[model samples]
Target: MLRTPAAVRDAGRHTAHNYHPLPVVISSAEGAWVTDVDGRRYLDCLAGYSALNFGHRHPTLIATAHAQLDRLTLTSRAFVHDQFADFCRELAALCGKELVLPMNTGAEAVETGIKVARKWGYQVKGVPAGQATIVVADGNFHGRTTTIVSFSTDADARADFGPYTPGFRVVPYGDLAALAEAVDEHTVAVLLEPVQGEQGVVVPPEGYLPGVRQLCDERNVLFIADEIQSGLGRTGATFACEQDGVVPDVYLLGKALGGGIVPVSAVAADAAVLGVLKPGQHGSTFGGNPLACAVATEVVRLLASGEFQRRSTELGERLHSGLRALIGKGLVAVRGRGLWAGLDIDPALMSGREACERLMERGVLAKDTHGSTIRLAPPLVVTPEEIDHAVAQLAAVLAG
Candidate 1:
């Protein structure tokens, strides 16, 4: 008879019930695969929600982490660390921005962007104090902090996390007219995800980003693009906004920035918009620490080479083509671009959670977002054959 694994039982006993994880206990991971405690291997289709874009323990990132650990790790924001200047400078160049504010997580970066936008509104845009407003979309997922979740459309993330933060407006995800109607003179910023990851990899309309940029420019509002999950090389471009020829006033970046080694997020913007932040107004203890900087600087250098972006573009086509063919079989629809995809399973067959569980049993690890939608985002290092393998497994799971 089969027995439950001790690792799984222990994990459930010890940890908080915040995450309903799969029954497998991952002991280690490399490239696009993770091994359970019993030595079973599974293709990692989630890629840590696009965090491990370079794959787990990438050599360059690990080497940088090791070297930096020996020399120094933390200096907080109180004193300048050796890695501070290079990370800030390179990340700024990557965003085509004049300045960078480092933070530890995606939530912190989102909060930082909000604070900066409000300050910029009051100082530069000549808006009334405490009256600044920001416009957001319906299906956005910025982060889980109290302030960030206050604007979340997801009931689970937002409910009971209030009295919610005010001064933000929610409009439809891909409607330009609704957004235009929502924006007014008091609007300080228009915050959006170029491709909504948690909302089932939902892609906005083709011209939506450019339209937002035009509207923000016309209204003197900062266009803040939350690129934490959709940025880096996951979307086949350095930033998803590049696909639409739109340049946001502020770029909130995280995920792959730390090369899956450390938690590092940053808000990048021109001096005019970001200059509103004075010292002690915002900070993080481990935001741009030596280890994070060293790892992230290499991530920036890797992105600068353009190889990973090209891989995502070419390999993503192979992935999407395979998935699109399966739509009528068990998948109702497929959304997303580059290496990212959301497969909406036929409700008659299974829920997204059930599909993910089946895939887990068959050695593939994808995650369900909501209802019948499952998201597939393998590491950028995934090969064409591996992509084929993952898709084949999904086909078999559906067939059963």
Candidate 2:
């Protein structure tokens, strides 16, 4: 019989120690719950770090994946598959962009955006050849890709990953003055996350996103919004930037784009920016594969229906209210929008890791970032009762 300890031990025996996962050995999952190897169940509050925004094994996405699997899966960009056009067209429409460049991961999408921005900078914005620069914000977590990390302020993700990629500038997040100072004639793009998900669901001050948008427009620089962890109905909108009433030049999207069934990512931009790339400029093998497109197409359709976004908005209020009540009890602060949140636990009480362990003991699963900050991003499909239960569990943990 499989047990948590033996399963976890054997699983980690050979794997690299890059991740320090919880000891719970999950064997199966459905919707907002997962069953461990020891027959224990836990509420998945983290939701695959927003990758499972639609919940685990959503019926529509699963059916699409299964159907595509039986019919067809892969075809390199050398030839087009039937599923490609619809996926690209719909996603582009959703993003309000003229074209979509499909990729398989968020990092790949970010890299593609960087390349496109630079190409547009040279060919369109007239930035001299090797001098094009992109400005990023501090406390950003676009991805761990070498170039992405080159401008990252996180030590753990950035340290020793050098000689780092250059031509990137970093500025403090939410400070328009610093960003303006960073931007120059050679600036190709200003890349940012509408909400800093890894930095504890940190929403910028009001007007920050719009300010960035205006800055990019006036300076003739592309605005790339990395929505990998915060888009696709997780933030009570198709995109978190929508809440701020801002639209970036390029949208880097992934995570829920696959509906938690597969890896699918994309960059959506208007023709003038994305069209800078010719045929041979960028391509991915499994990107836009029939299977990915089929599943992601359904994902796009689901988002189009607006059901998940509504759920996130309505349920997010309840979630934030509950967490806010716990501020004096144990939480120091709560910050986020929609169903996504970052809770800063009182360090005097316990570290975020300890709080998470305690929450796990009570049948809730969550993830902690930084030191005392725990982020909550439950699946959008989660019910009101589940939200109350998770909040009550957190309250009980904090009370103790």
lDDT tens digits, residue span 197-310, model 1 = 999999998888999999988888899999999999899999999999999999999989989888999999999988988888888888888899999999999999999999
TM-score of structure candidate 1:
0.98
Model 1 root mean square deviation, Cα atoms: 1.1
RMSD per prediction, one decimal? Answer: 1.1, 0.9
lDDT of 2 by residue, 277-320 (tens): 99877888888889999999999999999999999999999999
Error in Å for residue 219 of model 2: 0.8
TM-score: model 2 vs. ground truth: 0.99
